[model samples]
Target: MTKHMDLPEIIPIFPLPGALLLPRARLPLHLFEPRYLAMLDDALKTPERLIGMVQPNRMPGRNGGTGLHTIGCVGRVTQFSETEDGRYMITLTGLSRFRVVEEVEGFSPYRRAKVSWTGFERDKGPSETDDGFSRDKFMNLLSRYFTAQELQTDWESLKEADDELLINSLSMLLGFEPEDKQALLEAPSLSTRRETLVTLIEYSMRGGDGEDIMQ
Candidate 1:
């Protein structure tokens, strides 16, 4: 995929409430909805292969195309293929985070946003590792969380994973509510995200609802 010197002013967004894409992270999406299929078709034809992954303001409204959160990550369509069932399976490699400047007028079936990359300029840098992160604490909390949720995993693979992979992959895979996922996505730094994840895991283990962390 080609690197972007800067984010585009107008871009199409895929408003998936619980789905998020962080810089340098890869997000896999299955496009079945007609509107999104059209969006993917357009993206496939473009050289940039860009798509903004955003969350809707509400759950039920997501299917009806509601207002979106201001912050989102831009991803490039790195891998794509069409299924016999007419669905488009694509993997997006995240590029940068962008804040919506305004909505643009468009006739396309998909939504478009005028965005600014001023706030997330740091995304172009290298990925964060476990240098100063509390990896041990994080892992302990993760173990508790998995047991609490009754989720099974391959311990060997998980332990062998790097800091970035472990943090980002679990952040996306965990059963956090949309808002909680958004908090992680919009975190200012990797360290901040790690702290937030630890806090949420602790709350869940204490018989408190995980979603209540934001409240």
Candidate 2:
């Protein structure tokens, strides 16, 4: 992670099979499995419990899941509660992009990594966006898709959102396929990611199958 006196020493990361992290958005997750349970315990004992959320690239064998994509967003653990079975219900707020520097050989059921963050180092802001009717058309289609899914959202809030937050949030949470999510997440800038997301959203709105993520 980039070192700034303001940013925490360790930005928390939570790796999940299918979950995705959108910057500036908060995701609530449950920590139940043994390895993750241990991870949560470790975080609880630390000053800042930050986690990275990444999606699996293959099916896992031990946790009975699979491999994860290379990139993920670092999140901070801002809230926590307990379940009856000793699991954790925690809220993770997205912070920055983290690249797994290397894998650590471990005995735990889940994977862990030594990571490097690029938030302070890189300009995450989008240089420009696709203007004109394309953006408007995509928004119209996305609104319809949301309507069909029975999800309620505040359009005003979304419209007012910064470009980075809007693109990242939609890229993570929208109806795109796994690979598409990765594409959006890995886009070099907020503008490019939004353009890609809009394209994917349009395809989904038209009932098309986005490509598989692993390929």
Candidate 3:
């Protein structure tokens, strides 16, 4: 178990678009790029073995570089293996979501940032339970959304997952836009994240043009 104090103030960040890592969820990544490979190497040397996963903002930064979203989740490398071709396959188990304080100037090829974990102290605690979750209604919406997107899944498995697992997994795995995923990541609570997930699916079903497709 990772205590709140176990998390570091400065950590490496991977600015991947459309990739979301929620607390208590696992994210698998394949690292082949030179910079990312270096990032993995450095992370392995740390005691926490953690890396921050953030989505790159669509807008450009003041320095004319790609800007990262303000919020991101930190993941610890729980599983890792090196490939014959020098690539690395790793699985990150999410620990907490953090707000970026500022990007640090560093000699590493990858980016690093100073982060604050004040508001997200709960992330290090036990998994959350959403009392307001309507399993049947949520599943119905998910079925329609999956059908429209032609996505296949094990319904039984999804049903077996707890509230936080189900919602967070869908938020991470669903083919929502980067912005939509960011919204889910920044949601303050489980119920709020579930609501945002439903809305995004509803908007997508409407072709994102404000049409009444439910009729």
Candidate 4:
């Protein structure tokens, strides 16, 4: 037997550079920019307060526009509060991955996309059975990398965190190159993402250089 998630159309999007929000992790966005402030307004009026969080390839183009990476995660706006001047404070909970079908033109100042997410499936967070040598090895590499970066961490919680939390946690903590982080975000499976991150952390530990680490 199989099940499917109910996907919502008219998904709002926020294209950010160097921003990668993985499934099962929380992304807090402070909507101060005028364009984004308008975006929040539209999302609030809709029943599904969800937005696709995508990263741009480079700097906002000379025209203040940027090229988006093909893949992204759609997040649901779980918390929202507004400021007197109109800024929005919100926390987006990760939902599932989406592939851009094409960019949608918006009347608002910010860019929007008519994203295609029908094929994407959100993993059911991971189960207890997902832990093993592969996971521990990855964590070990992460620990060493943390030491090299002089980052203080909670080993107890990391050790005890389930697969989904651990993966997202490592993603947020490790020194992943932008392209590499994008790759991890695009990776299809948890185990694959684990291996990819382990490889990157190992390379970073070896020389802290911004080199492609995944082999």
Candidate 5:
């Protein structure tokens, strides 16, 4: 496990919509854009191979660029391969969540930010558990949600997955809106995350128009 002090103060930020990476979860990405490819190359040279995965906010940034959310998770490049077409296929294992302090000025093609890891110290520790998790009820709700969305999954595998893996994996893999995914990523604990996940699924099933209920 990585210690809180071991994390870098500044990291290359990848502003992606609808992508969530919770602590201890893995996110696979295909990098075809030149800026992100450059970000990947720079990260690989660092010992930590860290990249900040932040979702872009709806507001326009300075110079009419995309603005990024203040919160983001740091992921370490764990697996990488070069495609024949000169693109990159990589998997990032999440390490911790951070709050953006400020953006650093640089000539690089991608954005960089100074981040703070204040309240998220728990992210560097072992996996968290949710004692109140109602597996059967959650499974039932998930089954209905999946059916409604016309998605398929391996039931046995999902049943076998531990609490953290199951919740975090679903939080990342589910087709929730970018704002909902951000809520899951910013959840204070495993139990809170689970509750938020259930609420989002329930809202979707009830035809709530995918509004941000966490407000």
Candidate 6:
């Protein structure tokens, strides 16, 4: 586990729609855009190596500035490398969720935020669950959704994964809409997230357009 003895109050923000990082989950990112590449470069210089993963609000300001969701998860850069094509490949391991207390002005090309982790301190701990997940029900719904989407999966391997890994991996890998993804990210508890995920899969199976949910 990452030792967050002294978490930074300020962090660089990477606002990408449909991308989310939950506590204890891992997110792999491809940094090719110039601004994000610059962000990566600056983060590599810092000791924290922390970045906030947030979603962009659909609406933009008149000045062309993008609006962002208030809540975001902070991730520590655990793995990183540069490709021959000049793109940076990195994996961010989720640390904790944060609230956007305020936006900070910066000389850097990317955005920065002064975030607070008050209500979300629990994100640092293991999730509390009743150990009553309806695995069969969930798998049934997932199967229908996958069939509808014409996707393939190794059912045997998927069934062998533990609850947390299965839930988080599918949440990140699935193509839920931005709003749906945000809802899952902001779920108050693991039980709530599981229920929400099952409902989302049902919705997709019922013609809610699974094809458009991001990869």
Residue-wise lDDT of candidate 3 within 65-141, one digit each (tens)?
53988899999999999999999999999999998888899799999999998899888899999999889988887
Best candidate (score: TM-score): 3
* lDDT tens digits by residue: candidate 6, 1-215: 46454678999999999997998889999999999999988888988888999988776662135487778899989999999999999999998888887788978889998888889877888755527788887787788778888999999989998787788778888999998888888988877888788778877765655453322
Q: Name the better of 2 and 4 by lDDT.
A: 4
Go through the candidates in order and give the C-alpha RMSD of each one to the true structure. 4.0, 5.9, 2.1, 4.5, 3.6, 4.3
lDDT of 1 by residue, 54-168 (tens): 8887645342344787788999999988899999889999889888777777889999888888878778777777577766666776777788789999888878888887888
Candidates 1 and 6 compared by TM-score, better number:
6
> What are the per-residue Cα lDDT tens digits for candidate 5 across 66-136?
38888899999999999999999999999999998888998999999989999998999988999999899
Question: Candidate 4 — which residues are off by over 4 angstroms?
Answer: 1-5, 59-66, 83-86, 122-133, 208-215
Task: Single out the weakest 10-residue window by summed lDDT for candidate 2.
Answer: 1-10
Ranking by TM-score: 3, 5, 6, 1, 4, 2
| Residue 98 accuracy (lDDT) in model 3 | 94
* lDDT (Cα) of model 3: 0.90
Candidate 4 minimal-lDDT segment of 10 residues: 124-133
- How well is each residue in 1-215 modelled by candidate 4, as lDDT tens digits? 01234656556778876567876677888899988887788877876676788877664552234377778887778898888997888988776788776776757777777667665554424332244446556666666677778899888998898786787767755666678888888877777777677777777766757665333
Better of 2 and 5 by lDDT: 5
**Global CA lDDT computed for model 1:** 0.81
Model 6 segments beyond 4 Å from truth? Answer: 1-3, 59-66, 127-130, 208-215
- Give me the runs in candidate 3 sitting further than 4 Å from their true place: 61-66, 209-215
Q: Is candidate 4 or candidate 6 better by TM-score?
A: 6
Reference-based lDDT, each prediction: 0.81, 0.64, 0.90, 0.71, 0.90, 0.83
